[model samples]
Target: MNSGMDPHSEISRNLRAVYQEVESEEIPAHFLDLLEQLDAAERSQSKKDTE
Candidate 1:
């Protein structure tokens, strides 16, 4: 197996496959809500520090 495939090409193909699989996944709504909460907290902290 993989006798004639260039090593670089093989690596590239594998990476693309993995990327596609990850890209097709659905992010949970709770994860998105958590991210929003984190952003809000960071902004609040930044504002307090500046004042």
Candidate 2:
């Protein structure tokens, strides 16, 4: 919600910030899979709520 950041871009930025903090060897494939699922669920829930 900063001056130049749109919601989509802001989400991307936040994801990059989190990714940077994680160790490469410690990263799990399921983490990315779950992130995507969670993101989708959030979007779906928001859409449902708005309606």
Candidate 3:
């Protein structure tokens, strides 16, 4: 544990590095449009639910 080489900590560091790399990438425009479409659909569904 003093060496900071515990398996759990190693796995966590590797996962954090992977997450940071993925987080830095740019999202495609089509994906953004799809997300917006999803948001609109959810809003429509919620409105229907309230009624």
TM-score of each: 0.54, 0.49, 0.50
Q: What's the C-alpha lDDT at position 9 in model 1?
A: 88
Assess each prediction's global lDDT (C-alpha) against the native.
0.90, 0.83, 0.90
Winning model by TM-score: 1
> Roughly what TM-score does model 2 have, to 2 decimal places?
0.49
Residues 1-51 of candidate 2 have per-residue lDDT tens digits of 568657478797797778777745676889999999999999999999999
Clashing pairs in 3: none
Q: Where is model 1 more than 4 Å wrong at Cα?
A: 1-23
Ranking by TM-score: 1, 3, 2
Q: What is the lDDT of residue 18 in candidate 3?
A: 91
For residue 40, model 2's alpha carbon misses the true position, in angstroms, by: 0.4
TM-score of model 1 relative to the true fold?
A: 0.54
Single out the weakest 10-residue window by summed lDDT for candidate 1. Answer: 1-10
lDDT of 3 by residue, 1-51 (tens): 386566578788898889989898899899999999999999999999999
